[model samples]
Target: MDSTLPSPNPALLVPPSMPLYDSIRGSIFAPSPTVLITTILVIFLTPIFLHFIVFHSRSPISLPTFLLVGPAASGKTSLMTSFESEPGQPPVETRTSQTPHSLECFVPASIARTSEYRSAHDPSLKAHKRFLLLDTPGHGKLRHIALTRISSTTIRGVIFVLDSSLTDVRVVAEYLYDVLLTLQSSATSTTTQSKKLLVACNKSDAFTALPPSKIQKLLEDEITKMRVSRSKGILDVEDDGEGNDEKEWLGEGGEGPFTFQSMEEVGVEIEFKGGSVENGEWRNCLSPWIGSCL
Candidate 1:
């Protein structure tokens, strides 16, 4: 019973810590097989895994495009400007656009996204509905851009804006007829996706502006005439031995009025909604309609 118990065995004392250099040298030169294999695997596979993730995130998705087409001075640019701007701000006046322009837009959660009524200030709604709004030149000469997009782009919808207050509806109707004809002709093609057309009767705030229903009827009458006139022209071409494609007709093969309903056969749906962008009246109807298409 010595007080210190014979100073405990010397071997029982803790060993000194390994030197830093020795530890480093041993780890480097004498790593176990599992550690060596793991290091090799990580070094070889890290770049591959990173590349896959980066490429996957960067891969392009076929974005749904909504085409805005109409005759010149139809407020297409104004509407485009308004939709892209912050809410409640007046739309910036834009001159007749001679080229195609596109804007990124989001449908609010109140619409096709969540069905829950999200306030206009809801920040989270911005992430849910995203699409591209492609504004094509409304000029007669520049319409080829719109047609090209229709053929090449994965279109979700078309907004054909026209002034409903104008007394002479033929010009608007004629342009619409051309656009509809193009869509109808391409509907059967394998490359084109089926799309809906929304005929927006702009300037509905004017006293003379026609209601959407009336505008629809007027367009129907004019399109019927256009069908007849074009058929005669095609016949004339045939008479000259330079026949054209019969598929260019706007509606069903008959003498009946060329109603928008007839476009369903060719996979085009037609809808008419009247609103005045000048008064900020269209966003409620138009935004939801666009979201549904996406």
Candidate 2:
């Protein structure tokens, strides 16, 4: 036998690779019916798909807002400053806020996103990490601003900050009573979206500071007294008063002390959280609570 076989046929050799551009053009312009149909479909439908996926809603979603309201010196401003700063940074001292101010902040993994909440299957939809934190002045005169903002459709939550060591619980409880009442007034309809309340008992590090549970109990008792006092001050309206009583009450119409649970019946859910703003302990409790809301 010959040492080497006859030379392999040239036809068995591989051809040189075609340019990418030429390959694409040939694929698109091929005479096969399926290729033509696919090409036409891509040309006509790609833009439509892209238009919906990319440019459907250009304006940003109205971010979910959380309003911080409390009596002055209760650490509302300090807490806001703490929230604005990164963790482990020495606590920043905040001046008493003179006017209502809003800070757009990102709470990673705790934001209430419109995309995922409103339209889940959308490619543009996602649970964003953005929310608006509105810190209102806590002075008695400035509280009207907070009350008005509470009714806003944009606000999803409220934080009522109170000094846990305050000598006078009545005043703080009075302020909280007003807030809970405001939340309850609109909580009537089951169809309406209810707002959440977080009673932040700040300064829990102080020796005199009461625990969150004690603070909640004191507030409930004080509100019970107020409801009775106000119920006695009823005044009559003369102009065809449509067979209505002139008194407004908080929680249910029972005789016992008003509990935060009563508010849930009307849709306003209340949570009591104790934290030391001086040490930035609030972030731990708040992160989980906000995540639950989302």
Candidate 3:
């Protein structure tokens, strides 16, 4: 036999490397139709499934309710606009100008969007609660409907707004005091927990903008004075044999102690910003007094 045995058959010899075209042909020609179809289906269905999960996860059991009360031109509309424009959502404007007597405007959230809106905001903030911003006509007429909506069990909070630059602060102050008195009386009668209140004290942007510290101080002083005035009224009621010092504090007539606790203790945040409408310097001013209700 030849030393190499006629060299191992040439056909049996393996090539050192495969050609690029061969690799390309192998990959392109053997297409896996089943795998391709499965991948396509997954891509199409993933987003729909995820969206369903998110929607159901955030759905609310019940919506929260909030009340908005203030003097005319108190920026009730503007404040609502701001809240509507809060983060992670589009601005939703829902206003009903013609409310019943004693109530100027009633803005309710759209029932269709109630769930989506509430779910986006932080739950701890209780943003999902249905908010009924009731813009009362004025102090003169507030008494009529004061008990109707103000005292409702569903009401979670009250926003009392006023104009900062008004010549006579007394008139606005008196109106708020009356409203508070009514609320206090109602709370006493009902076993349901009283709703929290927030005073906006809006339009700090008028004249020179008041620093938050200064605004806080003014609010504290005003609340203290209101409390003193209320305490005096409480003292006037002659003590009854029942020994219930609070029992004398009946009806909406007597002024209960005013507190800075709402401003001091609750989620009563302040913003010294300009009005949305031009030429309207003191559009809205919510009282810091409402904070006590929270």
Candidate 4:
């Protein structure tokens, strides 16, 4: 009837004593050979385990390298600069003005995403490959050298930038024709593989000064004409039906069809500050063309 229960049994609450704490303390103060070996093993294996988790866990895809070529002041440098960057990635930029041209190394974010996609979708696509953006100087004299470099390098694609403020369409046409000729003549072994050509009509800030519709029409016309020319060359070689002649003709002055656009009409925004143009931004504009080629 008492409201309070009888006092709890104190003896039952006490734990049975073993020298567990003392043993642990002794081991810490004066470690045994097995303890030392175990500690060393943990120290050595921790990093290896972590590395496998971090790196080998994700399957990556082989990203293709791209070449950036255009006339001087055609915004190639700016385009390269505007390419998406990943944290902790090294910046890529051109170093020398002449001689042995070298591309600055940087990891493109697009390639990273593509690699992630491959890992998710296809296991066979897993491989460690990089998208190297090779920036070549656009001087007329170095055109041959640039072409040679592009040909020798395992280029996956080419981005050709063009200025759209030309007064005469014929001049732009000639320049484009020359670029096509160079690409066709270059010593690339893959004949059937189609290389991507992205024509960025840069300096769209001059859109207000020039008629946008006219610029677009001119660029479209030039692209159509170039494609027609390439098709005609392909047909001519087929008609001849001689392999050597076909190869010769293709190597002489034939190129794949190029996707062209005026950067102004394409809505490429060029940022400027302190009397200097900053980076340019094209929102997924080149993705379709790149996808087709890749």
Clash number for model 2? 0
lDDT of 2 by residue, 1-294 (tens): 679878988866745454676787787677679877888999999999999988876776798788999999998877877767788675677888879888776655423433336444554334346677799998888899998888787887899998998678888888888888788775663367666999999999999999988888888888888877765443233234544342266777635777888888778999999999778887666766665555
lDDT of 3 at 137: 48
Candidate 1: residue 144 Cα off by (Å): 1.0
Q: Go through the candidates in order and give each one's C-alpha lDDT.
A: 0.81, 0.78, 0.50, 0.53
Best by TM-score: 1
What lDDT tens digits, residue by residue, belong to model 1 across residues 1-294? Answer: 557655677765746554677888898999989989999999999999999899988958866788999989988888877786666777777898888888887775556645567677777665657778888898888888887777555788889989888577888888888888788777766555576899988989888888999888888888788888888888888899987777766666746778889889778888999887777777766987887776
RMSD for all candidates, in order, please. Answer: 8.6, 12.7, 14.5, 14.2
lDDT of 3 by residue, 232-255 (tens): 655665343323355333222334
Judging by lDDT, tell me the better candidate of 3 and 4. 4
For model 2, the local distance difference test gives: 0.78
The candidate 2 region of ten consecutive residues with least summed lDDT is 235-244
lDDT of 1 at 60: 89
Which of candidates 2 and 3 is the stronger one according to TM-score? 2
Residue-level error in angstroms, candidate 4, position 30:
29
lDDT of 1: 0.81
